[model samples]
Target: MTKSTIKVAALSAAIVTALAGCNSDSGSNNVTERPTIAECKTYEPTQPVIVKGDNQDLNFQTITIGATGDMHGRIFAYDYALDDVDVNAGFTKISTLLHEERAQNDNFLMIDLGDTFQGNSAELFNPLPIHPVVETMNHMEYDVWVPGNHEFDFDRDFLFRNLEGFNGAVISSNIIWHENAVDCKNTGQETPFLRGYQIFDYNGAKVAVIGLTPSHVSSWNASNPDNFRNLDFKEEFESLENTVDEVIAQYQPDVVIGALHHGRSETHGVVGVNEIASKMADKFDVIFMGHEHARFIEQIDLGAAFENGMDDITVSGDKANQVEDKAKSGTYNWRNRDSKVKVIEPGNWGWALAKAEIDLFKDQDGNWKIYDTTLSNRTVADVEEDAALQSEMQHVHDKSVEVANEVIGKIVGNFTNTSNGGADEAVLEEQVLNSEGQRLYTTIHSAKVSDMPLTDLINQIQIMYVEEKGSEAIKEQIKVDVSAAALFSDASNLFNGDTYRRKDSANLYMYDNQLVAVNITGENLKAYMEWSYRYFNTYQYGDITVSFDPEVASFNYDIFDGDIEYVVDLSQEAGNRIEITSISGSDFDKTATYVLAINDYRFGSTMLVEGWVTEEDKIWDSSNETIYAIRDMLTEYVGLNDLYRTEFENVNWYIKQYGPSDAKGNVADEDKGEILQLREDGGEGQDLWERLQNKEICVMRSGPGARDSINVSVNVDNNNTWFVNPNASNPYEGCTYSNQPK
Candidate 1:
């Protein structure tokens, strides 16, 4: 039999053995599981009802809002191995926590902020009809949920299909869909599709929950905008303000809640937590924010209820601050307004729970008003896995393992891609030891250089895939000018001689970034390189150490491959790092247009590749109509090549030259001033090139670090992580680089 057939037979046999370990007694016989594909297909949409037992009572004074977001397919809890942090992230543990909270509090409501679907490497590649993750949510019993930007990671229909399996109230004020929202609005009945908002009767409290999705969902899947072009992510802040006013005038609820799939930030307005928080505090009593999977806890006091030139009467509450200590006592008639609210944003995954509890009292007039409140947004870590929940998910987990291990191809040899923050200990000890025999990583006086095969491999994969998407004439007209990728991990080492499994290919490339090819001019390409190299710090005349800004996310440290060679003069400022010397060993013409292959995320994400791409110039998008995820493409490439080998990689195209050489390496006095002048000018002359080639001034390579580049920072914590263009209003800053008509 051929290799592909033989491999499938082996995988099938292995799946039987792996699946045998699952809890057959529980998984196979659970009548409570969701319906079959046929039943789901023919089913009509219905609102998920609140399940009540004989002991369950609807009357309660305290109302708790349970929140979750960015589940990202983490159905089971696993060890994360962070040193200072405990990780208990998954739906199983979250299920137990949610269950316990319901019994303790009389009124408990749960909500999932967008990103409810997608993610989880195992089941994602070939998902079952009824997603097991959503089925698990059905068991946990959620009250409401809205789609996140990633919800569109698959086809638009796929999201609607998954929503079918979910047993929760669907509420999102900003998601404007073409098919479902109009019917739901006209009928005014609770349906499974879409709605502007939903009102809940929490005992005697009439609480309105407003759902909002990320506004940038449009650019998020730019490569595959065809699937979601019919829908639009409305301008949220203003839309939310209008919705709150309308909900008050119509429903006249005692309490209003803002639950969204948006992240919290220190900055105000647009993409800021404090900015949106100020607007929310005007009408909503409680808010749950998500998107960025980080820990946060804050009690934003937007002055007093009507203290900041506002009226409580707009929200059906008494106006003006009429009590001492409005925050603590809650005695003002405006207390019932959106004043003195609490916001929680439990971290992503099943890692933790975002929780809020509000105490509402019926005044002498019998109108519900807030008495007191408490809020907490943190992770629930180091907890025991819920055994029953674990059993329910056991079969799916086993199947994931079977699928993850399916061999796709074989590798020629083992390769190195150690992500030791570019500081190789062995390289340090042998090559970068101090004059006193100390490892340079710990010393401020050493420098090191490491090969970046991981980044190289990713670039190669993207380029190969981008080339295949078009014909020879099209490619010849717009050659892959350059391809971009990053060494996202420090320890992605691939084994040689072993068969490459589907999971191994995933490890080689994590994240579901699809391929995008766009046309960029030579001038814009230089600017793009300058933007990428901003992660590296400038060099000075000291006991130099090669260190990176931890604030700069590792994903931003992208390397490029093409028919060009450029030098990164680290001594320059953030916007002036690259010195493009040649295009195919000749002067680069500023007007030459070339095709640039990049992952869809970078091209569309606010934090990375947003500044350069022109929307109209998009040539070929791998996800235009279908999600040809880069990882899946890589797997295909490996299988087609028969042997996944890197020996064929040219390992050329670009180089990193330190700025010290431009200053004074082994240069004579006559050329010292000239070298410095050309370095600052970024000239393309041959004499300047000869001076840059010498390693005595600065190390140059297509790798991580070469000697000890200076003493680098070893302390990298999660809090220090930062993104590019975080403060821009339009993630792309309206900077569309190309112009191609639809």
Candidate 2:
């Protein structure tokens, strides 16, 4: 059958079943009868209600009313990480607010627009499953509840279980049951589910409340299909339109209110609510919106008649007020008269509460009319805590606190109980000293070097370089080269007095091992220097001069070659190899590869360093072990004569002659004295010893040349990695695995 035919057939079947059930009840005389007028008390409005005399001779006087808004509950379960204490406290607060409202508003009938369960820890562990939240709502005495999208989070069975004990009405106009009445009966008390909308009476006046949830729930629930299987949430406007018509015809009510669990219109715009409101403008009087957490108030009018293909005019603001005044003329004429509708929304998180009061009045003809509607929103503040409520909520709060405390301890150790700076330093020191320290075994992903006194080292290096150049001309050249390296490489040089820190392997404290700077021929050196200048040009630096032969060929990389290569000779032989005088390759590359100087994390291959792929590269352990090695070497070199101590004093002079320059072509001023002092003290230097014991030192040794060209290998077997390959079209080209291993 076609889809339309199937739908018609299903609808026909539903109508037949309903009619049959009604007939059976009528035949058995089982339906409850209504009371006669003589047995009921005369209806009277307990509050003032102003009315405008019009059709039906409706009297103008006091009328009973009900108002409710901002019933935000269980929304927390959807998207929050809270401990048990906070969750339970939240529920308790909701309960307290409900009770407070119940006591204050005599004619008030409480209703929730859904989203009560599923957000947080409380829902995760609620005993008796999905029903605990329902039980709490029951205790709060909800008059009616419309199921929201989250209501289906646990499946229909779980929903039914929790809703079983609820005394209030469960209403939804859009939900359609798959089974018949007979099937429902056969399924027993734990039947899969029930479907239909319900009507309730308030103060002798019949009021119909319809419920509709978002249609998107079908796809959103795909992750947990079993929970929402066999259920469908049709388009809300369509369902509401049909349901409102049927409801008005079956049980004429003075007011029609639609409770929906969809988001409000401020964000989605007036489309969704507008469509429902405009279509049912003549049908339903009010629409209660939920879902999106916002606040707004708007009106929709639908009584305008169509003329020639154009919509009828809608009167608003002063025009509407004038219309009401004109209606008081007692002409029973609706000509030039207009009606107004209001839409309101309140923000979420229990931060505010919305209050709306609708006053109904009877005209001279006894027909009911809306006198005046007042809306007021109040901020929740300085309210006294209900003692009894607090006691109940505290139980949940306490448990949550316990869980939070445990988790905090797990991540923070004893740091939580101590002072900040002092505690941080102490913990760091102890961790370095003890093998059980988290940092010792844990990988060091990055490092930050402080920028204070280090700039002085650059200045001294530059000055010393200029002095060594002899002639003023060569001195100028040396100054430029020294300035270039210092300016480009010195992250701290810019913005005078600014402190800098870097989280990388190339730092002074991390360089406890010996370093040997290889010398190149003047011609090749100029080329290398030019390349260095080019690389440094991309970075910023402080006052520093730098110059190089712009035309020379630096490294044997074809990628950087351009027209500039012809400006300088390329035949100059340059020594570009690093030789470790303190430790030979054999010393480190033993059968099992003995321990060598390197940072603790790199030794463990934490940052995924190249050449340290095998476990054997974890030779020297962390900086602590390397420091001990330095101490041992220094002690042996010093002997009883302390001859090495004198050599330490001259270390500064040696660095002044060969080290990278400062702005003045000398070794950095700040580091000059320290280098000498460290040399003199040897292993006995307090700073050196402290750094060693704290494992704050890093030791690294360089290799001959860029053999692999790649720094990091994506495929260990294929030897494919990233490197600054000058031969490639893209000099900084990254290599990928290509089946062959180099």
**Best candidate (score: lDDT):** 1
* lDDT of each residue in 1-742, candidate 1, tens digit only: 1444323324445555554443222222123444322211222233222332233233337788788888877777641111111144678878778878888985788888878656655334223445666667767777777778887777655666677556666677766543343333444432322565777776556778888887777776766776564566777777677777888898788777888787654211354455566656667777777776644444455543321222221111211111113343343234445454556666667656777677777766766777666665434554556788888877766566556776777777434432232223222211232221112222221111222344556777777767766433255544586787766534344555777777766665667778888888887888877777776665543212245553355566678866666666565778887777777557888788777888887777632234565788778777542326776776776776754435434444322332222211223335343223344444433332232222111221111112212223211121121112222343222111110011
Q: Which segments of candidate 2 are over 4 A away from where they belong?
A: 1-101, 178-196, 265-271, 303-338, 408-742
Lowest-scoring 10 consecutive residues by lDDT in candidate 2?
A: 441-450
lDDT of 2: 0.34
lDDT of 2 by residue, 1-742 (tens): 1111112124334434433322111111121332221101211111111121223332433222222233323322111232212221234444455556657655455566676665333332333332435544555556666777667755456665555445465666665433333333344332212233456544445557677776655544433445555555566677777777877788776666777667533112223665666556666655666665433344555643312111212122321111122222222112211343444443343333344455666656665656555443333322333455444334333433332222110111111111221112112221121111001211111101111122223222323322332223323322111111121111111112222211111221221221111112224333333333231111111101111221211211111110011121111222221111222222211123211122222222111222223443211121122212111222222222222111111111111112333322234545443323343344544443343224343211011011111122111112122122222432111111121133
State each model's CA lDDT, in order. 0.56, 0.34
TM-score of each: 0.71, 0.41
> For model 2, what is the error of residue 357's alpha carbon versus the real structure, in angstroms, after optimal superposition?
1.3
